[model samples]
Target chain A: MKFEIMRDRLLDGLNDVTKAISSKTTIPILTGIKIDVTDNGVLLTGSDADITIQTFIPAEENGDQIINIIETGSIVLQARMFNEIVRKLPTNDVEIEVENEFQTHIRSGKTEFHLIGSDASEYPLLPKIDDENKFEIPADLLKAVIRETVFAVATSESRPVLTGVNWIIENDELICVATDSHRLARRKVKLENLPTDVDSIVIPGKSLNELNKILDETSNPVQIIMSNQQILFKTDHVLFFSRLLEGNYPDTSRLIPTEFKTNITLDGKTLLQAIDRASLVAREDRNNVVRFETLEDNAVKISSNSPEIGKVEEQIPVHSIDGDELVISFSAKYMMEALKAIDGQGQEVIVQFTGAMRPFILRQVNDDSILQLILPVRTY
Target chain B: MKFEIMRDRLLDGLNDVTKAISSKTTIPILTGIKIDVTDNGVLLTGSDADITIQTFIPAEENGDQIINIIETGSIVLQARMFNEIVRKLPTNDVEIEVENEFQTHIRSGKTEFHLIGSDASEYPLLPKIDDENKFEIPADLLKAVIRETVFAVATSESRPVLTGVNWIIENDELICVATDSHRLARRKVKLENLPTDVDSIVIPGKSLNELNKILDETSNPVQIIMSNQQILFKTDHVLFFSRLLEGNYPDTSRLIPTEFKTNITLDGKTLLQAIDRASLVAREDRNNVVRFETLEDNAVKISSNSPEIGKVEEQIPVHSIDGDELVISFSAKYMMEALKAIDGQGQEVIVQFTGAMRPFILRQVNDDSILQLILPVRTY
Candidate 1:
């Protein structure tokens, strides 16, 4: 492969693809970035068996020449060293050439680096994900959904399926839910202009995090294509492909209670701050458990006690409270995270609970698209 | 302590002392911060066996009443939890009352924390350091000296004495030197209006790092009291005490060669950048070694080659070269660090070499107050 590419463009591509390249991967070839010079542009691919990321640099972008391809060829270079070389190459323009023996030469301004490359054929071929079940979502919207729901996914692999965020699409609406049995986060968004059949896919939480990282600062629409086993998110110049988990995601629709005897609207930030203060002592305990109680006259209390350490009690003023006088205990960390995930959307959180033993729900005051729920612990 | 202290003032004091509180300390009480409310002010002390940091909050400062003394008492509270509580308190003024039973109640706004406090009598007492050998230095200058020399201290504990920085005081001048045998860093400064006999002290590098962190933003003069077994640094509000190393520091004067067969002056930033780029390839090698050669003209070349990887060669333009043609190899990491420490002094680096295998010297151009030496490797 021979090409002269813009430094910033190549650096951006390298950083994007590098997210998928893992140093601990067992496959030796997966540790390298596959570079191919094509007629349209130069394609850089990085994969770690679980996810694959590819970024393309066209011959020209935004009326500026981005890459001038001299020949069409491919080579896999060590991702980390290659990334460092391209980023610190001391020039605005970079020229790369691969010899017949897989020797890659990268030159920029006053610096040049030659790297030993591997044959591209040694890399595992990425599975083809047909566009049969394709959809479109604004990059920012998808990023927001992932940010709002991915944090609740179970980090433990005991259940395996709970480590992923389940995506369900029906009637041009998309809903993503992630739960760790103790707490859950769900977000829904209406799709636009794409006609597709109902589908369900569980994507690993880690892959969603990488997708969110790459989508940062870009507002372009992202085209998503789902095959039987793989899902692809194609952004402006990047294609991110992640393998779908093979399992039945536990049905969570029946988990959220629709009928609530109590509903309290509270300032999201104030309650978050109160819980935060209580957690100062709660963290010393293994469970990080804090108790919340509804008070009279639009007031509530949050407290945590640790016998060896101390106890913290905070009173938070709410906008309105009409809930059956209740006392519930749950993880202070979980509640804080859920509140923060929905706190800054220009709305307070409306909390609803059936009783102290059932799972409680927190919804944005006026927004019905996002909901977070937590099961109370038996701390009596 | 039973007092109402300004949250900001108390927070600052807590942060200062918390630096010396190590969670992993063997002494159980060392994980707690001792709070003493006296007639003059409230003093907070935190110590691990090696270092103790005490910060005092006066009852009043600059016409502002910072603390309202309700009663005089002492208690030891868990450092980590107390620090977090004070920082996250919900009021400008914090009211802390210690019950007779060692139960402490911290009240701020509508939030309160009750912590099980330990008896202050269990905490280690601060050492008594006589002013017999005391001097003062500007905090900024001392901080700069520490930053320049601490990085060169030996990390390996094989030679315990080399793991500390040796401070030599004589003729109203203070000299600090640190070396790991492979490279050495020395910095010196003249004292003003301070009379003291010649003295030398060796302080652990880790203690110096902690001292640097506490001196992060303040620029006041700091009083230094050197006792037989301890050194005390007293600022306006914080008193930092560190145990001194007992063994004698090595005499390193004979290691720096005075005669030079080659002398080259180069821009510090440029040389640093070239070396940094070269290190990207050299890092994979066990030694992280890079080669430096003096060119015929006003130029120098830095290159590193990895057999499995490729080689990188860069010619760094120098201001002047007046020495025998020379080639030497040294640890790129050490050279980069030394160059960086000397780079931002608004001056270039003057390199002096005795021979290919001799210890070479790097000094700030036109300034002899600071000097760095590196021993060359016999690379075949």
Candidate 2:
């Protein structure tokens, strides 16, 4: 394999693929990124058994020489070192070549690096996906959905299925749900064009985070293909594939209550700041719980107490109030996460409660598309 | 103590004092910051046995009200929590009140925090300096000197004195030296005013780092007070105190050779990047060493090799060359640190070598105020 590519262009492609390479992977070949040089351009691939990423660099971009492919061949080199060398290389154009013995030579300006490479054939082949099951969504929209719900997934690995976010599609509506049993986050959006079929898939939160990191926030659409056990998201020049978890997701539809005895609407920023102050005291406790008490005339009391770190109480004004007077305790971290996911500046949010013992819901005052629920902590 | 102070002013003072408060200290009271409200203003102090910081918030600053003292008293509160609370408070003016029972109430806007406070009597007293040994230096210059020499101190606790930077004053010139046996850093500055006698002191690197973080890059002067067991730095309204190390610092005067067999001049940035690239390959080896081979006519060859990570070689252009060709291997990290300390962009540095086994020196082309020496690694 032999090619000459721009320094920044190659670094960008390498960074995109490197998200899938893991240093602790048991598969030795998975630690390296595969480089395939063709007459058209060059393709870089990296995987760690769970997820695979492939990025392509074209021959030219904007009338500037991006890649010059001299021969067609393939080789695998260490992902981390390769990325660092290309980034720190002191020239505008870098020349990369692979010998018959797989000794890769990378030269830029006066800097040259010779790396031992492995046979690309040793890497596990990526599974093929049918294009018929693919659907399109804006890259930013997908990233937003992942960021809103992925943090709620259980990360302990004790329940492997709970570590994944459940994606459900019905009647051209897509809903994503993630929960760690203590708290839950769900987001729903209407699909632009979809087939009259229902489908469900559970994707690991880890994979979604990696996808979020690599996906650019552009209007460009990303094509997603789903199979029985794997899913793939393809963008302009990058392909991301991840294995799905097998298990039945809990029926969270029944978990959110339809009626509430009390509802309080308050500015998200004000409430977030109040909770942040309370958290400084509550975080010393195991559950990190803070209590919220609704007062008369659009006022609320926030308080947290730790035996060792003392206590903190804050009064925050609300926008509106109705229904029963309520007092409840929940994780301060969960509340902060819910507030951050809400869109719009200084928008008011309604907190609905069925009872102190049941799970309560937090929703935007004007919209119900995104809902975050937190179970109250029982304090004696 | 009872006072109403500007939120930002109180927060700034709290943050500076909190740097000396360590949660892991065996002395429990050291984790709290003591606050004294007097008729003059408010004084905030924090200490962790090894270091102490005290900052006074005056009644007014630049024709603006900063502190309004209502009562004269004192109390201590958890440093970390107090700093966080003050920063997150929602109002420009914060009201702080201490009850007779030692309960502290901090109110900002509608948010209020009630913290269990400690008796100020339990906190350690500040060290006393009776002697009038004092001098003044520019804050930026002191910060620069600390940054250049502090990184070379030994981190291991086997020799506690080596973890500090030695400061020696002679003939109105302040000389700072630090080393961990493998490498050494020295910086000297001539002062306008001289004390009657010469003096030397060792200040812990950790304390200096904390001081550096709190210093603002202004032309303001920092007054230094040296005593038998402690050193104090007073800048504007803030006072910083650090305990001196007891043992004698090693004499590093003879370690830097005055003459050399080979000397090479190169650009600081170019050499730094080449070493960084070579480090990617050398890191896989046991010693993590990179070699530099001086070539004829203003050229230097840099290379590194590891059995598992392959090899890398690059030629860095130089400004000038002298003496014989030389090949020496050393730690890439140390070399990079020295390069970062150079004051000017595109500055040329002369690297002087005595022998392959001796320590090499790096100095600016026309300035002898700063010097860096690195011991060569045995590559065999």
Report the number of the highest-DockQ candidate.
Answer: 1
Over A264-334, each residue of candidate 2 has an lDDT whose tens digit, in order, gives 88889888888988999999899889999988878999999988777888788888878888888889999
Whole-model lDDT per candidate: 0.88, 0.88
Q: Give the TM-score of candidate 2.
A: 0.96
RMSD of each: 1.9, 2.0
| DockQ for all candidate structures vs. native | 0.77, 0.74
Q: DockQ for model 2?
A: 0.74
Residues B1-380, model 2: lDDT tens digits = 78999888888888788888898999987888999888878899988899899999888778877788888899998888888888888889899999867889998887778888999988888878855788899999989999989999999978899999999988879999989889999999999774555388899999999999988898799998888799999999899999999899988898889989998888888898889999999988877899989887688999999998789998878987788778889999989988877553588888899877889999899998889999998788
lDDT of 1 by residue, B38-60 (tens): 98899899999899998888898
Query: What proportion of true contacts does candidate 2 retain?
Result: 0.91
Listed for each candidate, the true contacts retained, as a fraction, are: 0.90, 0.91
What is the Å distance of residue B72 in model 1 from its true position? Answer: 0.7
